[model samples]
Target: MRKTVSLFAMLTALLVLLAACGGNQTGGSAGSSGAAGGGEKKTIKFGATAGPYSDMVTKAIKPLLEKKGYKVELVEFNDYVQPNKALANGSIDANLFQHILYLKQFATDNKLDIQEVISVPTAPMGLYSNKFKTLDSIENGSLLTIANDPSNLARSLLMLQSMGLITVKKDVNAATLSEKDIVDNPKSLQFKPVEAASLPRTLDSTALAVVPGNFALAAGMDLTKALKLEEMAENYRNVIAIKTADKDSQFAKDLKEAVQSDEFEKTIDEQFKGFSKPQWMTGK
Candidate 1:
């Protein structure tokens, strides 16, 4: 009888301990959220989509920020939306993956006060296809897939217009092209807007597809002779973006310097040979 009673008491104690631990965890999370806005720490957080460029910022820029007596934290964002939203909401200090035009679109769309601080590097988008060797060989009504995201969709459409597949309004900027902007549609190509990374796999399925340079590299698509590439010089340069309030902040300058540095660009050149090829595309 005493043995049985001891076991029951031990079980009761274990249950109580578990409940207390759970409560502590919940309280910890709540405490952090409450204190987030009141912290006096000398640190800045940067958000970037998980990719090579973002890794570059973490590897190169984070150190620079720290050397200047600022604690730096790097946050990775998976989707197109939340990173900028976090920046606007004070969740992160800045973001680096976006281009100038797209940053403007992000600002306008979300009604945020972020602005482009530095043009980092152009990813140089392209039309890659196993079905059609060249644009002229592409059939009328060739099913073309593009990125479905608002920013990338516009980029793809601008490339299509640049290739003469369609015509857009004279006043429409490449950053803001929409399906409605297709002023001329001669070939009547069937447009399929898909996720950016998924387009390379569908290359065999679609007659033609617009792909960003980084994803093309990820998919092992050869651009040496297999595809036509967009020029980075005159347009389509990517940049480091930040909240307008933090535009001139110390961390922003460190990020811009780190990305634009010769050492970092060398890494980009070596890792991504073709699209990151054009030197003029970099902010340096």
Candidate 2:
């Protein structure tokens, strides 16, 4: 009778232990899902190109969001194309890289419903030359390179026009202008359209190359040495973007607020080192 009782006790203990283990697992999972202080935290997956955009997010925005019990996952892309693709497919929650103009053009052309949340800063486009010391030194028929992408190509052309190197057709929209829009090329400057990312690489071969600020920074080109730099304009300021459906979402609001925060502005000043001018300062 005692042996049978002992066996029964052993079975009871085993059952109790199993129940305790199961209970612990359930609690663990619940705790895991909750933040340290016991509330659910939302994770925002933000996409950006791999340079200043990612740097700013890492240095500023990520910490700001995390302090508010949010998790920020930064997805870095090498090219301008994939960040929007990721956002549209729901692979990411938002993106911060392109300007209002680029974002609008990309969304319209790709039939994506992405929209801007807030403007960040302007990385002004610059014209740089390794061969020529001054614009006057550039001879007629000399080869010049510019970004082939629609928005940047137009920006590059406008920069050239501003320098009196070329004249674009009157009433032609600066955002969509092309080589064909050039009504007069006083220098007879031959234009070579290359990938925006490749314009820096072409500096050695081309007489002059107009490079976006981000690309110029990446190539270690001194902005002070640029023959000409495009002035920061409202349309050219980079912005955070999200799906149109998420325009009013809490995540979107949090992101916009975080970037617009004073802390983020300080970070931008520190990280970009005045290379990119904050749009807020310009009131744009």
Candidate 3:
């Protein structure tokens, strides 16, 4: 009878021990707890295009995050679409490749629940030419390659207008401006819209190409070789994007703090020399 009682006691203790072990396992999941608790996540996956944007995260942001007890993993993407998709699907914790305008438009269009954590320094879009040395040398009906994406298309078109190559309608909303908005093209320039990633390659085929800073740098083109560099607006600067639900979480705050740190600015100054500073960084 005593042996039977001992066996029962042992079985009860084993069940309790198993339950305790299961509880510990649940608590050890850093992703769920850190996000919910608004503290440091043990591992953070950052998505970015395979270029300067990714380098910014690697050279500047990752070390800072590691110091804060977070493991930083960078996922390099070849195109603009995937980084945000990864973030939306919870494949990555955040991304640093797109500007606020692009982020807003993409999120609205795709029904993705993502928001900007903070803006970072961005390289300006510029007109590069293998055929012409200057705008003065630009010929009538010269084929010009531009970004097909609506946001970047408008931005490139606006820069062209600023340079007197074209003019958008005075009454059209700038945010949603399209090729149809152009009222005059004094140069009679022909426009060919392609993917932003493909703009760098257009330089070889077209008279001129409007290359965004990130893609241009990624392609190893010298920013100084461009015929003209657009004056970047604050909203046009690239930003770190996180899931909107995580916006108020602790990881979001930490990510913001890292970007705004003086060390981040110093790193930008040293490595990303030609990149334009955002208003927050410039104190403007």
Candidate 4:
């Protein structure tokens, strides 16, 4: 009888130990899920292209979020597509890089359920030349390097047209405009379409290079050195993007409020000198 009682007690203790371990495992799972859900999360990861945008998040947005009792982390991407991919896969909570138009198109193409949180100050595309001091010095038949992607290429052409170097055919959609849209090339400037990232390198050999702002900044070219910067359209400004489902989440609200904060504008003015502020910022 005594041996049976002792054996029973040992079994009961073993059962209790297993039950406690199971309870702890369940609690851990709940805590992880809670962190991923709406208002409970204390950490946020932001993805950005490695340049001005990433720097903006680090110097400006991160500190604001930190003060609000959140741990902020930034992941820098070298290419455009991966940032959105990372956001969609939950590798990041938000991203700051592409403009609204690009965001919409990319989402459509990839079927991502991400949406913009708020627009931010964006660097504008500019024409740079190591061979010529000014647009006037550009000779007829000079080779010009431009971004091959349709969106950037269109902007490059538009900038050239604005400067009276070329005239695009009327009624052409600015978003889809191409070399074929050019009706007149007064300078007879030959365009070599290359990757946007490669445009900065072309300055060594090409007479002129039209570089998008991010790549230019990444390449360490001075924005002030550009012959001219494009007049940024509102839709062309970069934005903070998050999962569509997170639109009403506490984290999303905090991210939007952070951008709208006066501290953010002050940081932009001090650190991001040449970037064009979004309309909402300027309207304030």
Local distance difference test scores for all models: 0.70, 0.80, 0.87, 0.87
Candidate 2: residue pairs that collide: none
- Model 2, 1-284: lDDT tens per residue? 99999999999999999999976543222212212233232677889888778887788789988877677788899888999998898888878898888899899999999999888865689888888888888888989999998878988888888889999999998667899999999889999999988889998888889999898878877776888788767888888898898787666677778877888778877666545565575453
Candidate 2 lDDT score at position 263: 83
Q: Which candidate has the highest TM-score of all?
A: 4
Per-residue alpha-carbon lDDT of candidate 1 for residues 1-284, written as tens digits (9 for 90 to 100): 99999999999999999999976553222112111123222566778887755765676566655665556678888877898899888898777776666678768987999887666544578888887777788888888888987777887787777778888788787556778778788988888888888988988888888888768766767655446787554336666677787665545565666666677666666655564443443432
Off by over 4 Å in 1: 1-43, 63-71, 109-111, 136-141, 148-151, 165-190, 195-197, 214-226, 233-235, 276-284
**Model 3 lDDT tens row, 1-284:** 99999999999999999999976654224455233223346678899888898899999999888777677889999877999999999989999988887899899999999999888998999999999998989999999999988778988999999888999998777767888888999889999999998999988789999998888998999887899999898888889999998888777878888898999999999998779888888983
Of 1 and 2, the candidate ranking higher by TM-score = 2
- Residue clash pairs of candidate 4: none
Q: State each model's C-alpha RMSD to the native.
A: 11.8, 5.8, 4.4, 5.0
**Candidate 4 per-residue C-alpha lDDT over 1-284 given as tens digits, one digit per residue, 9 for 90 to 100:** 99999999999999999999976543222112113334355788889888788899999999998887677788899888999999998888899989999999999999999999999999999989887888898889999999999889998898889888999999899878999999999889998999988899998898899999988988988887998888888999999999897888777888889899999999988888789888899998
TM-score of 3: 0.79
